[model samples]
Target: MQKIIVGVLVATFSVNVLAWGQLGHRVTGAIAQQHLTAQAQAVVTALLPNEDLAEASTYPDEMRSSPEEFWQKEAGPFHYVTVPEGQTYAQVGAPEQGDGISALKMFTATMKDSKASQADKQLALRFIVHIIGDLHQPLHAGNGTDRGGNDVKVNFFWQDSNLHRVWDSELLGQRELSYTEWTARLNRKISQQDISAWSDIDPQVWVSESVKIRDEIYPQEEKISWDYLYNHLPQVQERLKMGGIRIATYLNALFK
Candidate 1:
């Protein structure tokens, strides 16, 4: 009975929800690349061949513009998991086709698969890098309502924007930092214990953390400006930092 309920909830799962815009993904990617182990860096280099981890971070998102049926179907649902307000990913049950949580698990498995083709592994690595960054952007773990804040329209500096878009690029974009600069600004010496703790955390756990942020981020009014930015900017940077650190953790584990 419990299994049937979970299956039913999973069936209605949505996919390819919006994520951190290009610059944000790159920021996290750069951070992760900086922290990778020598062994992991070697494997990532071999897998990507021409692209560095930071450069490859946006591939999954870039592919969204492709018209291929395979990409349209297979790559869609992995971008996010809708946890809904007041509920957790596990409590709501993940879709069988997979959300970010399931996709992260699957993509990591593909990365470790000796039988997987180089192209396939490369694709997996890109998706893995993108998804970890996505999972950190509070909005990526959408609530069952509001389409992950996409439907929640608001004004940024008197310009129209949605809540998700604010987090995706607008908020992060406010800093006007290049990806490299963002990486440099956010670079911190993660304590050994913090690295150990963050590296192996489950995707479901990421969703839970994101959901908490999502809930708290709802603006008191429709207009957001520097005051809002001033307050939440640190929170945003922290997410980026965690995204980078955790991403390195995932890569290090895969290549180790």
Candidate 2:
């Protein structure tokens, strides 16, 4: 049954953990190298190990019986996951907010489930961590239909892919920078208060914030391709930076 859904989902639109890693490398780099609380730094560090794993851990089938079931697995050590919509927190029992909130909830739940296998819980935790950052991305939250624009086909700087996939991996990976190199460039301009104040917050707020950003992302057009890229790459980078900083803030609160 799970396989069926995954298959269907894959057919409709497929996003793997590698997508997360590619985005995270840039986002995480932006989060680190900034002055933050020790707790926040630690949370970012914990997420660091899982960064590259996003490349291979696209195993949503193993996590739960359905998308809702996947939400139930939200516990902690890491805090976020890509939850399918139409499922509530009470129904799913995981983190109830957006990617970060949902991921955080899953992370907390995994820590409490002694009956769960270590590997199962850890995989869940890794997603929780990764997804929080994903949620902060306005495009990841999407426009309530395309699973965050994954289905919105377009030519991203001439590459043929959907907007969601473009945002998921292509744009960030385009420059061929390591996670550290990307963050280094971003962190240079961050202020001390931005680092301190950005730490410690709820993921729900982040989700709401992204939803607002979503409207600005998509215009009423059949295609959002290279032309859109020329116009919006700056917005794209800004959102990625926002996601990284916001993710660092949420994790700091959790660990602290």
Candidate 3:
């Protein structure tokens, strides 16, 4: 009976995540490319045997939320990758904080955790790629509420959606392109310097940058209409392009 309930919850969360285009997963793929060094890229490229692509997806929860009602204690790998209290990713957490300064810290810890099995590490690496991408999106940092923009409702291209959903898919998914197609479309024209600059991995810097752009991306009004999105397509595309490149940069660092 306990197992059955756990399976049902996992199914629900998976559906919610997928309905959002698995934005975090898509970004992970982009970041994996960004972070892979040339040599690592070659390795990953080869690793991309058809089987690999077919099997790629985010990890499922190892242990479901227990206590029947403790949603906050569910403790997925994502929980550790988020911002801690009071301090932004740019500033170091107080000395008592356990390497809570950046998502990368969590990434490194999970990679080295004795408790995590080999499969867990693989899952961690995938999410590390994804979480890095998540960190880059300003709204994901949020202002201590709304689970980023997940709570902020709006109309995206005539569909009812929230600001978080818009950032998750409305923008990136608009082109209806595959990962390669989307990456190729955006990759050709970025200047080398710009790529180098955007690739910086400082969590504080990423957070700060996201906060600054947050307002521009999401206006205060709740019912953002089609005109709003149309007006912001350029901005939307820029974020997606940046997201793809920065993801590659972070992933490259890992393999290097």
Task: Report the number of the highest-lDDT candidate.
Answer: 1
Cα lDDT tens digits, model 1, 31-140, are: 89989999999998877778987888899888876889756666777887877677777787666656788888888888878899999899889999999998999988
Cα RMSD (Å) between model 1 and the true structure?
3.4
Cα lDDT tens digits, model 3, 182-252, are 65566565677868778776656766666666656766676666667677656655665565566566556
- Measured by TM-score, how close is model 3 to the native structure? 0.68
Ranking by TM-score: 1, 3, 2
Rank the candidate models, highest lDDT first. 1, 3, 2
lDDT of model number 1: 0.81
lDDT of 2 by residue, 1-256 (tens): 8657544443333233233445454455346325346765554445444443323233332343355634343321122333345443234333223334544565667745778776665565455445656566666543335655766777655557766666666666777877666667666656767656655466656666666666666646655556666666676666556656655565455556
Q: Where is model 3 more than 4 Å wrong at Cα?
A: 1-20, 31-35, 42-87, 90-103, 110-117
lDDT of each: 0.81, 0.52, 0.53
Better of 1 and 2 by TM-score: 1
What is the total number of backbone clashes in candidate 1? 3
Q: Which runs in model 1 stand beyond 4 Å of their true positions?
A: 1-16, 189-197
